[model samples]
Target: MSKICGGIFTSHVPGIGKAIAQNLQNDPYWKPFFDGFDPIHRWLAAEKPDVAVVFYNDHGLNFFLDKMPTFAIGAANEYRHEDEGWGIAFARPFQGHADLSWHIIEHVVASEFDPVMCQAMTVDHAVAVPFELCWPGKDAFPTKLIPIAINTVQHPLPSPKRCHDLGKAVGRAIESWGGNEKVVIFGTGGLSHQLEGERAGHINVDYDKFCLRNLAPDPEALLQHDTLDIVELAGSQGVEILNWIAARGALTGSVRELASNYHVPISNTAAATVLLSHSERVLA
Candidate 1:
């Protein structure tokens, strides 16, 4: 049976992409955030997962406000990246695991969750930036891709509880698959930062810390806040934390934090990275 190795959660701010393009990682302003990945690099080298199921939000590269599904999963042979007017150089196309994608799609639907299935999709910084941070300077990504896009950009978005439930469903789907592939789950975007409106450029350090502290030990604590409450506390754009909440839901095993780093004011967002390892056996 397939094994879920672990999950990595990080912010997907577009400015991070531009920083990589210009080689600004070591620069003082970016050093602390870039340094956070050092332990993640070591962990990836050791665990070496065969597949990556990414939970991220699409930024107009593939979906728009007019027609956005609450959840979408990619089932393509290859996933490409395009400049979504961010001006960051496009990374090489990532190879997709179509077999696994289909398995997940079938399982999730059987489990009573409807998600749009895309055979051809273009990923934006949400997917690309995290990949670069995980395995910097790679000519090609090491793991086969399964991109799951969540609708954090539109109104009536999935509540934190709903996204968490979706992750639980996906986790069960992976464990039930017959393949022996080792998998890693990624939840990208947000700690806290708001853009636009009168409350633009808002950052909630206290609430961000509360989330980072509880995400591993007690994700249930996060679900108490409805989407509107999250907007009030984390700001409108800060609702991206829903992705992290979903990713944490997928770990059915006993989870332990391997490493974590939190820094503020990265592109007007509270930048954070967390590495969590799951036990080999699922907890009952």
Candidate 2:
């Protein structure tokens, strides 16, 4: 039986996790963060997921404004860095696993979810941050990655319902895979914050926590709302909540809240983290 080890929701605010993980490597606030993750760490150590299907958004790094996709999947054997306008600082271009990725595409499409297939794509902070967090020290994980890129930075963005539908497709796809390796489907993004234009330093702990409370099970309830509502209440860029809905759709039943941490003001972003695993019942 294939079990979803768990899911992680983090802000890929470029160097946030890297810095936090490094600081926590030998610090106190680490407890607020790392300490909560002990159970997940133990689980990770034990289950050792063989693959992670990640849901992230790109900031016009790989595919430019020239042609954009609402959601895209890598269909190549290897993916390289796109200069990112700063050249490859992290240097090692992220590699892709074709067999499993193809399987996801085949199965997801069979479920009627059509995702844009990418052969050549570069990545930006959205995708980079999460990968670095999950595989700090680089070769630590014995898992292959399937990146699902959502165009969060650019508009005419996909509707919340669309994202949730994609999530259902993703979970269904992974469940159909005929493999023995454990897989963790992660959706990376925000709880609540705005980092652009005039509203730059936005932070609402109450809203962030409220989101965490509703996110695990009642996320579909959010889809009934629209962009105007989100931009007005959660900040324009805060529309990333769609990423979380997509994640929730993939994992049904109960979810165990593993680790959670929230921080204010981190390099043009407000940040938060939460780890969830499929529970026999709802997370408590």
lDDT of each: 0.92, 0.70
Candidate 1: C-alpha lDDT: 0.92
TM agreement with the true structure for every prediction: 0.97, 0.85
Q: How many pairs of residues collide in model 1? A: 0
User: Cα RMSD (Å) between model 1 and the true structure?
Assistant: 1.2
Q: Which residue runs of candidate 1 sit more than 4 Å off their true CA positions? A: 280-284
Lowest lDDT 10-residue stretch of candidate 2: 28-37
lDDT of 1 by residue, 81-155 (tens): 887984665657889999999999999999899999999999999998999999889578888889999998888
Pairs of residues clashing in candidate 1: none
Whole-model lDDT, model 2: 0.70
